[model samples]
Target: MRLLLASLILLVFIPLNAQTTRKYSNEFMNIGVDAAALGQSNAVVARSNDVNAGYWNPAGLINLEDNQLALMHSSYFANIANYDYAGFAMPLDDNSAFGVSLIRFAVDDILDTTQLIDEQGNVNYDRISLFSTADYGLTVSYSRNLPIQGLSYGVNAKIIRRIIGDFASSWGVGLDAAIQFETDNNWKFGVMARDITTTYNSWSINEEEFAKVQNAVEGQNQELPETTEITIPKLQIGVAKLYRFHYDYTLEAEIDLNVRFEQNNDVISTSFASINPAFGFEFGYIDMIYLRGGMGNFQNELQIDNSEQLTFQPTFGVGFKYNGIQVDYAFTDIGDQSVALYSNVFSLKLDFSIFR
Candidate 1:
């Protein structure tokens, strides 16, 4: 009970900080099969490769020499659901590259809502229900090298959509921009701003049925039906620095802070802030295999408030590359109190590149 109360207090007292809403869109956008494998940390931005660069730092694509394509899939929370990602990058010239990517986050069958009444007051009969929520996006990006120094910049435009049941669907647009710089000492810095202009179209509310139910209980007749178009705010800001050490080993750290801003969106209810800071270290062995591990929202720092609070635990993973192909995986444990989740998350990623 004490833990529950603390969770509630933390949820309620938390102030608005991050500036985005429909976190599902953001989460769905960030999910990566290899992101976990590379340290489950946000710091990998400075170590971008040809394929994963689409998500980490599109600017990194300028470093690629050949046309490359990659695909990745992840099993989230063990079996509760899954996400799939695919991308392709092609070098337009020595200093520029273009890429496109698709991402999908899907959950399994869920209980369907059925209206019911019982003699005991108010209740509904439990029945097997089927439903699912999904988010997907298509992004096109271009990256170019700056002429003055070891710097690069890139931009991506995304088409986003979400589906909930047969009656509800929302669509929106978002964009991301990134900058990267490297130094002679093997130090790198990266900055990214994502979802700069994201907004949802609107959701359906079955006004006729809602009115019938409301009138039956309140004994009041309503003449007009109104629907609300809720606008979720755009999010901003992510930065990271990476340092190379000895023995082909490197350390990278990243911090991402964002907020959910929405009005009339019941799921989120109120404005909330989240700070996700992660650290990762990657070591190369024989110049072919890479082992990485990191912790996120370190120590259950990221929180969501509702009747039940949800907190994420530290996550870790690793990766391997050989003969122009890279394979990655990650593991995550939600915690013990989670009813539907305890030990969960098995992810896999594949990346390929060719040099000209």
Candidate 2:
């Protein structure tokens, strides 16, 4: 009875902060990739034109002029969780490009307390063990120009693998499609269909390990555990344009709309689909130094009085590019509508043509 009561208490507090499989399946993949993109609140769907575009809007990969490599790292909750990304892109021909990207999000050194109690019903600190939970994603992307001038299309095939120590594991697969069009005036339009085929994950749980957890709880035993998760498709559309000024100054501004076919807490919701808008802009000096800012992730939060309020996230960042090496940094917050928790993100991009 003591272990059962203690396990019930742990259940209420532990899983609340851990990765869950119920809703938002494969959510780590949606955390965004590059620092430049996240710095601008992921409003770069129309202007992603380098290696990082492999995870943003692959169609923009068609604009790659030289082979490129990108890497980024970010941590959350005072280094409790870590997120990392790496990508490579190259122009295959004058009108085609190819890229590949890898992403990982993990929380390590978690204590497993299910076995902390001995057979004599006494607390045994030495019996506790440590474990980790991690998720990984690998994406391969390709883009090519269409017969129509200034029009390009792209596709992505994604593989998802997840592990929860020795307790559970899963494997998933998904596909994405995207298109980009540029007008004579340098205006760009882009659309991306994420998980167009409805990604599916099949879980495999270790019965022996799970039995320890089951015995700890009071009445968690069920006939069958959930073994599958499905991720529905979503759409993102964006428009952007660049402005050139005297003395080699430039400005780029973009807006993106994310659409999901379900009722949620998005800023714009209806019986059909909900839409959330993001706005971002970049200022450049001589095409070498850049300043970026954005606002996004608008949601309707309920208050104590049952009233709803609109809230959003704001971000800013800076970048320097010299001799084919680019360094970027962003001050970000992932808090939706609660107490703010801020973190720092850094990324680097290398242009292989510089060495050649």
Query: Could you tell me the TM-score of candidate 2?
Result: 0.93
Please identify model 2 stretches exceeding 4 Å from their true place: 1-23, 222-224, 336-339
| TM-scores for every predicted model | 0.69, 0.93
The weakest ten consecutive residues by lDDT in model 2 span 12-21
* 1-356 per-residue lDDT for model 2 (tens digits): 33343344335323423343444478899888777788898999988889998888899899999999999999987777899999999999999999999999987777778878888999999998877778999999999999999899999999999888787889999999999999999798999999999998888878887788777665756333457778989999999999999968999999999999889999999989999999988999987999999999999989899999999988888999999999999887896635688889999999998988
Q: How well does candidate 2 match the true structure, expressed as C-alpha RMSD?
A: 3.9
Q: Write down the RMSD of all candidates, one decimal each.
A: 8.2, 3.9
The residue pairs in collision within model 2 are: none
Worst 10 residues of 1 by lDDT: 6-15
Q: Could you give me the TM-score of model 1 versus the true structure? A: 0.69
lDDT of 1 by residue, 123-176 (tens): 665632455667788889899999868899988888777665453556667778
Tell how far residue 351 is off in model 2, in angstroms.
0.8
Candidate 1 ranges beyond 4 A from true positions: 1-26, 36-38, 113-129, 204-276, 298-312, 334-356
